[model samples]
Target: MSVCDPSALARSLLAWYDRAGRALPWRKKGNERPDPYHVWLSEVMLQQTTVAAVTPYFLRFIERWPTIAQLATAPTDDVMHAWAGLGYYARARNLHACAKMVAQWRGGQFPDDEEALRKLPGVGDYTAAAITAIAFGKRAVVVDGNVERVMARLFAVTEPLPAAKGRLKALAAHLTPDMRPGDYAQAVMDLGATICSPRNPACGICPWMNECQGRRQGIEAQLPAKLAKPERPTRHGIAYWTARKDGAVLIRRRPPQGLLGGMMEIPSTPWRDDTPWDMAELAAHQPVAAQWRPLPGLVRHTFTHFHLELRLVAGKASANATPLGLWVALDKLSDHALPSVMVKVVKHALAKAY
Candidate 1:
């Protein structure tokens, strides 16, 4: 193992990065400067999402709205529709809001400083630090899930996650060098993702293998311990699928506040932890007076906090007038910004239509 000095560690990691850094769409080669807009967009999409899953979406977004100004000028519904299947709908809303703030208020320029960047919607600590370091060529302690694992393994941190995050951040900050901080940040992230993986880490090829305290102790794989996650609570609801004779569907916009807010959805009963399946309880929340028939099976989805099971009820609306919500033509369903859950509800109801 080489000396356990911070400078030595930084030098070793950056040298390895020069040879083996992963090629990503958001990254720049050699001395080329990175675009802050791209960095912010990619970082926001990466939250709670994998890189493989986000790559196509990122490309699609860039192709459609090439600049922050373009994105800011786009309709909110358009952005929401583009963000369909990304799971977290709130990120899409915040991304649009942040882009508008940057374009309209800041004149299409992102603030280079971490503190100022954090004020933007969806720009958290890690994201702010990443944008400052990578896009603006500033020194910032950028820590994400990958960095946490690398730091925990390198320092042989024994405390479980959530509890050890503070200590790990401090250790990471200590190792952050002043020279080429952006490359160094990317290097560490690459090392963690490729070498210090969660299971069966490739310690032999790691640049910091000799310097890793966990490797010396033969506990690299088990260094960053995590507490057991509690069982997620299951919630139940019923979605009403009312279709007119002309093939128009009744859909409503969710209140712009909580989960799946501002997204289009079929009218439904409130999701509750103990919702009863009784006919009387389900009939009360029906959107219009119709002979509703319950579809077989349930539309199940998992959110960050809970599991949701939605029952689908299909019925024919007698009148062309939709008193509760808008009547969208079946062919134009894609025009609305419906979340994945609502899309599933619609598909299930259509498949079982009489």
Candidate 2:
């Protein structure tokens, strides 16, 4: 098996990139200097999210907080509210921490070196490498999911993912040219995303079609195999929507760590996998001693690890305050940082309200 020349691959991909690269909100085109702040923010938002889904959020974030200094000074609740619906709430926390570190501790400058970037909150190997290469124009191998797929197809690597990541990184490093390393990284990613797609890759137009081992073997779509994920377990719980006659809803803040931590949510029973919490058990944990009426049906949501089924109980409370939690006006609910699950709970409760 003949190995594709690294220099040749870089040249081909860079040329193709010059002609056709993704016009993303975070990327710079045609020799323009990349902004480290935009790069960091977009990369964080892009994690486990698609480009289409991230673009509007990226624009909104930049519009709201244009600089690291601005983002650092923003209130945590405000940041969380802005970050609502993006999911993966911890990223929002880490993003704020990283910004504060850069703005206050580091004098409003992002570290250019990969090692230093890694020390920042939420930045790992891939993110650090991407920032170093793209934002700082450093010579670092950036192997994201798209790059991994491109490299796997280019080399026809058959080792399954998670295990094959090291080999893919090594292969990608070999092709990392010092000149325009950032563009090369984005180019390879664009190729995988647009051309060397997982399903029916458009090899006829791919720059490396001639040299791609997987393409040559007529198995471009089958390279870079992944291990099958196990079925996620289902958990059950109940949430109470105790609304005041004034149209305010009772809500509480989650503990500062773990799943959906530091976010606002309606009072709910403990989420458990053993058995569904009955109405009797759920009623005992209600925020107010109102005549809670169980809303028909269930609110279901899936997390990274498990699926949740929540039974919602809505009732009107005459009291202004609960023993625990606070009453937030229904109109002001959007101001709070509610996770998708909790948002779903609110929507379900409201939709069923008579």
Candidate 3:
């Protein structure tokens, strides 16, 4: 209910940001208009990823694509390859689809409206709003973890986060200036990332320190209460590692549309229901004893959806297996784009095989 003068706040914060904002690759430099493609791409990569982790990927993507039209015309495989090292393969797939849609269907123009951007593949509410405001200078309220945290502390919000997120967002919208909404958005984000950090916040350096309710109340750390995350349950699965005496490893392409999609991996038993793989199935598909060694360590990996505990059973065959997987020289592992989970399993098997 307390209306802050958003325009004055934005102008003051913009002055501070000129000296304090971190140099990020995606941002528009002095006097330059923001690039919609760069903003959109950075926003997509930043979801569920930290700024440090996304910087390299953003740079690489910009170098590779350079323009929205270039990215739009790229092959799906090439996009996937470009995003190989980056986790969250689904984002890359969605990026490719969105890029193509925008370039071909929209005639190489990005939608400035948040609602229209949301209609694009992989563009969510936050991303659409952020891109709209930052790239096109639209009056859209952008909310991310940084913004949420900053807002929560500014007003000394005590409502638990996630649960309190709706209220916080409403409050943030109230503080967004009609003019320079983009600068205000970036300023608040910079404040959260640096001065208002999650731990050991630098309140002394914050421009909003005089007005921060959390600091005034001596509860800056406690303002943003978040519910504890549920413990992640572990599950087990098996992977079939078949190597031919011709020195080739059996590799299969994962289905092109889901987790680990469009990548190579050792043949894995079905991952499902938090269940262990059947011993009988492994015996039937596993290679002969003399030529191959069944390496003993478990390949444990964590995914956003679930934790995977994988067993690797290795064996060598005289001839290449005729069914699903392709045989490639063991030394050529670098050529194929294997998910890190599969790579871990292979490395574990190889380390102890000899």
Candidate 4:
């Protein structure tokens, strides 16, 4: 019954988890161990993305490539296409790389130990810890944002985040129980997500309500304070909607590195903090030379750290015109891996067509 005792705290949380844990696509039921492939895929998709956003993508990925070996053998472009709308395109690339590594060298079996798992592509401390505990049933500290918030409120830790991260992880490590460590880890995350929310928490029904010091102090909502983040800078670019006479659009694969890597994109000038694109620069980057007219509206999309403004221009390819990239038929665009931003460009261009 002692809240300060890690074993007792874990026991209380696990009991709640047994009744209230989320029925996610990857989560296994009672006495059924989690699949490491599902665990890895779901965790990767969940990064910088919400559960609502990731659910369909996870389902699609699993449906298409059910196993790690299948995913590794699948074409990287296909993976990127399937992962188009999911931001952080680099994760998709690393996912394919990791899958290939695991399939080829590890004999398609994910490593159970934290140290061994950490060596895999895109598997960092948090991911390695999560895989070790949730998939392998090993005792490992899992300190995701949800866990950090839960710890901060449970113990009334007052230091701001980033600086407070170390302390929070230490507390989470302490509470990480040897018994049912996997369930305990997920239970804490579920508690944070469903009950100890960042806004109005449902502490009345929280299993740890009586143990919560932040609630006693009347600041559980504000417990895990954070330093203010700097404003996201706005970047400007131009999206050229180059349509071939055959109703195909010119799209190119992004460079292997950098933002939106390995995804298909409408031909565009470099996205920069510089001014709205000058018409003269079109000669350098435009897919083909033709009469270019400005589209009616601009496409605005936000990345994690920046705001993007894209002006669209339309031009048709002549019979002799040979563009630099692949010309995908308009209706078949869905088959290609256009990032969300390029999807906007296509929509904007199509709006002008009708």
- Rank list by lDDT: 4, 1, 2, 3
Cα lDDT tens digits, model 2, 1-354, are 135578877887898988888788898767887789999999999887889888998999999999989999999988888888888889999999999999998899999999999999999999999898889888998989998998899888999999999999999898889888788878888898899887888988988878888887877778889999998999999888888877888899999788987889989888999599877775577777878778899999999999999898887787644448878888888889898888889889889975
Residue-by-residue lDDT tens digits, candidate 3, 1-354 = 122765666667788988877778998777576888999999899888889989998998899889989998888877877777678888988998999888888887899999999999889878988888889888898998888998898888998978998999998898887776677788888888888899999999878788788898999987689998777777777777776766677888889877898887888667765677766666555433323334677888898767888887766665524656677888888677776887797798777665
Where's the lowest-lDDT run of ten residues in candidate 1? 274-283
The regions of model 2 sitting more than 4 angstroms off are 318-321
Scored by Cα lDDT, where does model 4 land? 0.89
lDDT of 4 by residue, 1-354 (tens): 655687888888999999889999999989799899999999889876889999999999999999999999999999998998989988999999999999999999999999999998888898999889999999999989999999999999999998999999998988888998788888888898899998999999999999899998998989799999999999999888888777888898889999888888998888889588888887787878877888877989998889999998888889788778998898999999988888888898899744
lDDT of 1 by residue, 1-354 (tens): 354588988998898999999889999899898889999999999987888999999999999999999999999989999998886788999999999999999999999999999999999999999999999999999999999999999889989999999999999999999989789988988887788888899998999877888989998888799998999999988888888988888998889889998889999999889664665776688888788888888899898889999988888889745558889998898888888888888888878875
Q: In model 3, how large is the Cα lDDT of residue 181?
A: 62
Superposed on all Cα atoms, model 1 deviates from the true structure by an RMSD in Å of 1.6
In angstroms, the error of model 2 at 264 is 1.4
TM-score of each: 0.95, 0.96, 0.90, 0.97
Cα shift from native, residue 306, model 4 (Å): 1.1
